[model samples]
Target: MPERQDPFATLFDMQAEAMREMFGRFAGTVNDPAEADLGQWTEAAEQLRTMWLDFVQERMAGGGDPANPLDPAHWMQMAQGWARSAPFDPAAAQRMMADGMELWQNLAGAMLNTGGESAGEDDREKPALPRQDRRFSDPAWREHPAYLLLHQTYLMLADHFTRAAKEIDGVPEEQKGQLTLATQAMLDAMSPDNFIATNPAVLKRTVETSGQNLVKGMQHLIADLQRGQLTHTDAEAFTLGENLAATPGKVVHETPLYQLIQYNPATPDVLAVPLVIFPPWINRFYILDLTPAKSFIKWAVDQGLSVFVVSWKSADASTKDVVWDDYIRAQIDAIDHVRARLDVPAVHSIGYCVAGTTLAATLAILARRGEADKVASATFFTAQVDFEKAGELRSFIDGTQLEMIGKLSPDGYLDGRYMAATFNALRGKDLIWNYVVNNYLLGEDYPAFDLLHWNGDVTNLPAKWHGDYLRDLYRDNKLVVPDALEADGTPIDLARIETPAFVQAGRDDHIAPAESVWRTTRHFRGDTTFVLAGSGHIAGVVNPPAANKYQYWTGDSAAPSLEAFVEGAREHPGSWWPHWFEWLQQRDDARVPAKGKRKPGGRGDKVIEDAPGRYVKMR
Candidate 1:
């Protein structure tokens, strides 16, 4: 009854108890039904505030006034120091330390055993060691125990954070995803590579530059702040109509939704069926016609195919009422215009990214309404009709995030810049930090890259259309389900689509996962050929044969489970363009020699403007 607790133990217990109480209060606020309007961010903000205050108090014992301690930059610096204050869970850290010790012991034993021994046959034949992670590749860091310790500690913490986030109980899926993302982002930001203290390369650079890199980095940061966005590439280096979207074409037709550009025939003989393209409106249409070397439009035109491209108008407050049906109607109108202009029985159709989903829906509706004959065949590039495996981007489209986005778009149109920023975050290391370091840290100019330039040229999404897309396709997943989606007063059934299909999936695509794109084959009853390209979404589609780069995989002339397909497939070097062109030719009617007398616009009355039209050039 009179047993007294040790004062040191009692003090530590009291401190731990205080922390638990604080966390309990924060968790209660999160779980409270009354705070539902605030969503999961309330707790995140509260935790961040607590962390910030603790960090400031700990660091500024003899400090001057902490001006704007809540500043994001200050918070970032504080977060980087969090590991020094016990960032990892105690249990997880103990386990990691034990494993690390065992590894160290094995390494010491190996070093002890290797003493002037001649290489044996088995040693010589040994397979090369697995490639090291880029962050740990530098040999200079291996010479120092402190550097090694920092690297190992950060990696161990990263692993534990990922595992802990997945094991978190009673968290909403979206919240869990956000937590995992945040954890990884923190670990990446705090990585040894980012600092001079832990990174030998950075230390050497600092020594050589006499700390000028820091000054240059500061100047770069100031410039970026003034610009209000991160610049990844030099946009001034590339002009839309001159160097990019340079494929020669004229706008033959225009609608509220899009401008139709029929390109000049490069080959004397053109296919009887014209190819009508539906490009995703989220970005500018120039991705398909980025450059002479990678331009799909140029390749198609050069292959004796008459080509027409749909360049969607960037949405504005005036076009806020535009919806899914409006896009479908515009597509139908474009196809009709192409058929009328070229005087063909049917037109070949191709869709890229979001356009592919819309095109599939349009074709399905057309099939239902007995208008399927308008499209001769269909090809999709890096598109998915099914959204089940839509990858990491899906997490940002949940109810909470969607609502937040809607609130931000007061003018009834989602800002294109915001969309671009989100995409940049998906691969922040390559798309963001590297640029940050190059432009700011190293005081270097952004390079002139066609792809990066195209990436920066984004377009707005009409509020109604964007909302419908997120709710219908992503949230409700109604596209694949029969009668769940209707356009032009007709219900759609993908099984009714009789158009021969060519579906291309990128093996490394994180946006539309390969399996997600491969599933489209089952929806079409007509012949389908699915090819798995060997890169991410953009590079895979823009692959040129001359590059002699990334290989593609093809199997038993049919679509199957992605795993089975890849397993049974044989790898082929170079691009998939030639294979796709051959497939198109097989189904196309006889080619006819081009008549120079007939320009791009068949009847001049329907012509609106030139290629790379007003819509594309619009801000």
Candidate 2:
């Protein structure tokens, strides 16, 4: 392995280069870089970049073989050459070469150890166990010589290629990311477990079913084709306004762009400051209101907080022209509507994911115009204001890529499937191939999970707004820089936001990495609470106190870095909801009668519709 380089020599230089490359790709012309299509290629490669598409294509050709086009070993051979070609890379080639030597030597040792072994042989002669992966969890993988050989061989190749792709030192960061994605996708798609011939469990299941599972698998494949993606859950098991978003509420205000649903208070008294939720239009709002037990909205109402949520209309021809400012304005409109309906000077607000990014901007606008008092406090869930650390999602955000995807959709709007594919590709192991093996290979039933159902219910984005948002946030990353971005003629400065804010991030969240989410403390001027939640984006925020499943951490919200924060933090059992509620109480615990009527946002005596209104039903 090579020694480290001096920070004075390359850290800043590399960052500058990466930034230039990212923005260059984003700002380039349609013909820019000839790789303008790289983003689209990466998106399509999500199937293979992340490993679903190539695996499917190979499977269509019948059982797995060494000559499979997407084999990890084949890609690993190419990837090793990439490492070796990095002339300026300090030790990248040396490290990879040494690693490869170690891998082969270890594998050879394992083979020699296992040479004369048969089933249930002496433990001393057995090979070293492969790394623990769910894919190799079947006992037969370790006990059966033939399967064990394939399993260990695949793991070694996967590790070698995955490492080489990740450490390729000479390429620009974006290109490196794409290559890494492509490499991993190949490895994932060509895993032994994915093949009927190589996987003991799958092969056993196939034989037991007398190949009837293949028939079931064909039917499942056709269903996935019709559904347009692998089934993550039993979609038929859940429905909105019933088993799903069943929280009691009424759609009291309606607009072509949004429906404002005001929840009926579960208690006789509710917080004086009404609570309005701003969910990202990228997903339906029902995510926060899953089943009653899992529903954040229902839980908040039960905690004596009056709740309202904005249900954004799915983008179509009517919404193609809605720009970034429009979303900011719509959020302000909702805040004002809540204040007017509840007869309160201010209300508390919550924004999740992308909506949270816009909310920070809205607060900046309000603060700039001396209207910051519109909201009493704010909370953000797994939201990112800076995109530099946004993880794999950033890989698909260059300028040409954005343009190419919208061109494939109506009125240049981004089809939800593209967004879906991008996200699914990020965690292909869990999101794509796991389901592929289970449903299409094993012919098993998909789990009936509310989260997966909501995940599948994706929303389209207006092309203008989509491109603008990604450009400013992901491409340019202007939000964290004061006044770097402007919305509706208001120069946005996040530091201008003086409202007390609570920022929660998932420790393992890939979309909005914890480090990125926590750094918002640097931007806001107000009192801020930063807590790290357990699990990924969805489970982290949607966790109900009753479930008591995951833990959270809090310490120096003012910590300079994530590691520093962890060093100073204390782990607390259960959800962060109670802590947030206590913070809200400290701000203003004043209570009002749950207003006794479900018509808080109603005009005179007319109710617009039931909760989870028409706008949410658009898809």
Candidate 3:
């Protein structure tokens, strides 16, 4: 074929020239060694050779071909193939990267000090080690003179190959028959006047003129490497099932009691007030019961308090009829059952996330009928009682979207995947783009972090409950105002709740923003303490004593207003775990042994084995 004056080819040639110039500049900056120091140079050269050989062999065997520039489609196909074949080998990748980083550090140190003649002999013999290899491998390392020319040459050819492959892939199957005719017609259609008139052609011309292929390539590669390293690192650093494993704590009468409970010594003997933990039904309760160091449950149990945690049941199609009211009823039933067995007059209740909202509603319903004696105190964690400022999720609950989802299920529940996708879209840079680049392009595995794994373990919401929740709370912000929401035909009034209250809000929470949690303080008429924790929703509530990096701000204002606490909070940097422990201790009533003779056949018969509660382990 005759030589084609391809614009893309010309651009590629220019990029090659620029790359050579940049490499030469970097090489010139390196200090030159004396002839007598050839031995040291030889050793460094041999190390470099070994590294390069290993990289080449690895790439040839399975990794991306260094001789091939990455085409999006080819890269995706190759990555998917690799993932299917080998999955994510996090351990192996971590080890390889670690070794590579050490080698690179040693090589750089040798060059930088040049035997440390300017410093003492001790310094020359033992150099301070580099920082732990936090960053991924820099592609720029290949710019050394020895590999520069060959690497560039390989990349150029690969680019051409990738471009050709992409063109072939983009062609419609039906149009393949008239390829030559279409090409000539395209040439006829692309006359300079037509190109100037046509927006598509004009846009094409602008891209060609920018001459940004190499910059784009480098950007793409950097993104790929970063994603790969993160995936590999996360996978190696975390384990989904393993991290969620329950650690054994003190057992009360053959039942596992989380270690966070405490009881006050100065209270009536008849009142056996236990802390009722209402963890979100979306995941297991063990996020609060993680490990002794991070375990809120464990900490509480150790405080000499009686603790009762709700173990949620998993739902299948059989449980489709279960509604929001059913959950509230179940919780109240648990309370009655616990009271009957323990002969407790009242219990302090702590609710987290969605469960917090449910418990708040339950309290309101009970209070409206003057039945407030059932509960002693109420606490919420990153929970929203006022949905007026429901944060980013507000945009998603428009009439049209609600109606569309309502049509899918007559009752109004949206699919769990839909919710997951929406949450994922919110942080597309970190969730979507990062995963795409890592798993699809870099052939890396997903991490096994406990929280992230829990996040991935999605559960379906009942259509009716979801629809009612979004429309009433999010769309209209009805929950906070008077007579806004009705439970089983009874209106919910927050002013009726007279129990002592504790509310915790995280500063960086995007899910239930701090403002939403803070608003709950306005409704409570009794003693209240508002705490500002120093992490996101999950991390803040799951704040174990071991996570000492956290800080908290608490205010003296028992004011009936959220704004008053905002003014009172002075910034204090340290773990909030100790403060919460102390605060809960003050509120806890004195514990009493089970008043009546122990009932032989109580709720314990139905209790499942001590694993993560069913809802959490489902996925």
Candidate 4:
């Protein structure tokens, strides 16, 4: 029997066959076959064959090295050897291919005399077509075909090496029983079950935290396949609970809030005390009201504060024209409507992430018109009023890139898909490469988790709003500086507002750097309290009662700024939820009868629902 060919070798053969077919098609396009230059055609064909043969030989030689086959110890040696012998070196293969293709086209044009005479003047005067845009254009590899070839080749070699390393490390070696036991102990500690029970949210986060590694491994085996899979899986897996509890025993609101209007007879009564929630459009609002034990909303309600959350609807193409002004106006209107219905005093507002910017804009707009009395207090959660030190993501959103993105979504709407991809890319080694190995190569099914599902539940931004935000906040650092922005031609100044304030910062947050959050404290003139919490962006904010493992530090003095507080404050080992609730309660007004008590309109009787709200349910 003939020797079985390697799967990759078969791919190479297919590529060669496709190239031959392309050549045949090019040859057939000649109008006058009799006038063709056989000499040039023959020479070009021979060169193509030689190039392919060299590529095959190099592949065989690299794989045949028995000493280094799938060995991590030999990674450096294998990389060096492969790099030295790369057959597809930049200048060698690409230049030759370009030159040969040009020569071949010229010969065809010469043979096809049908339009040559008529087009001679036009051809001479026409500027050379701009070089076709290439996929990879790093100048370092401009003249290095071998570098490109080896870059691709090493990906495959690396995957094999990684898998082999894992296998070797997992097995017991001679006279190493203790080492094996220690390794097993570590693996047990990191096992998904332990993480799942201790941190239910870890199921989804493990995938995100490890997504980069998965993508890298998958990219070598299947281009763009891993991204597609992740996108689909994430989009599909997102789910929000269908029930809500306004009070412990009075009423159990079990309707999908997204589909219902705020039409409680008590709407007028509850509206008296405005509860403004700033929910980032990036995900659903339930992160705050996650569960009864950990639900910020429940805690607020229990404290006799009338609470209202900004329930952001799923954005699609129709939301393209909704700019920053529209969102600010909607929020302001919602507050005003509540005020009208309740016949009560000004509202207290809480803003988070992107919502913080929106709230800042609203406050500025209100302050410009001398409507500051409407807002009683403002709380910011990992929100940055100043974007100058906005974290690692700042490096990516300079003017040029933002402009390009603006053009793509001119209405200022940012595509959620693009945003997801960018965040994934930032930590490609873990988020991407790991999944490629487990999901695609190893064919593992995605594990389940609510928080990850929420993280993946992305929403789009209006092109106009996205552009304005990037320009004003990120690129211009407008919100942090007085007179840095204007809404509807009215200037915004954060310092002029006298609303009491509370701000929280996460030490490990990559989205909003702690410094930026600290700088925002300077922008507030009200009685301000800033706290530092342990955890990343999402975890720090969504921390539930179950997460007793984490700790938060608090202080009374606003001197030395946020950075000083972070450095000096002692860790009070416990969930930060209780502390935050206490701070908020101090600012909350004492309970009176809801100004205009509204009767419930036929929902469920009093009952406790599962954690996560209706908006978070998977579609």
Question: How should the candidates be ordered by lDDT, best one leading?
Answer: 2, 1, 3, 4
Residue by residue across 1-619, what tens digits does model 2's lDDT show?
Answer: 3343332234234334433433443335233554454554444324323344554676578654323222335335434533443334446556656654564455434544544244446455544464658888876565443455456657776887777777766588876776677677768878988876566676566444545565567667766654455678987899888899889788888777899988877788878888899999899999999988899998898899988999999988888789989999999999998787667899899999999999999999999999999989999999999888888777666654665555555565666766776688778888888988888778897789888999888788888888888888988899988888898999999989999999999999989999889888888999999999999899999989999889999999888888999999999999999998998999999887665443354446467888888888776
Candidate 1 has what TM-score? 0.79
**TM-scores of the models, in the order given:** 0.79, 0.82, 0.59, 0.58
CA lDDT, every prediction? 0.73, 0.77, 0.54, 0.53
Question: What digit string (tens of lDDT, one per residue) describes model 1 on residues 1-619?
Answer: 3343333233334334433443343345445535433533454446445655654574577453223211245334323432232233567657766765654444322322342123243245432212245666665444333343445545665777768766666576755666665566676667767654445555444434445555556656555543445777786898877889998888877877789888888887788888999999898898999879888898888888888999999988989889889998988999998888777789999999999998998899888888899999999998888887777777667665677667657788887876776687667667766676566555566789999888877788898789889888877778889888888788888889889999999999988888889888877878888899999899999998878899999885463578888889989999999999898989965977776422565543456667888889987
Superpose all Cα atoms of candidate 4 onto the true structure and report the RMSD in Å to 1 decimal.
22.1
lDDT of 4 by residue, 1-619 (tens): 3343333334344334433433443345542445656665465446545655664586587663332112223323322332232222343445445554453344323323222223234334532222321222332111122222222333333333333323343233321222222233233223222222222122233233333322332333332332222422333443344333222222223222221123222222332345767688676676675445656676665545566665665555667676666677767876675566446668788889888877877887787788888887787889988887776566445554565566556434565655665565444444544454355433345655555555555666567777777777786787867776676777788887677777888888878877888777777677777888888677777776565757788875476766567667878876787777666557653555543332322343232232333444433
Q: What is the overall TM-score of model 2 with all chains considered together?
A: 0.82
Q: Please say which candidate is ahead in lDDT: 2 or 3.
A: 2
Pick by TM-score: 2 or 4, better one: 2
lDDT of 2 at 272: 86
Which candidate wins on TM-score?
A: 2
RMSD in angstroms, all models? 13.3, 13.9, 17.2, 22.1
Best by lDDT: 2
> Which has the higher TM-score value, candidate number 2 or candidate number 3?
2
Per-residue lDDT value at 376 in model 1: 90
Q: Return whichever of 1 and 2 wins on lDDT.
A: 2
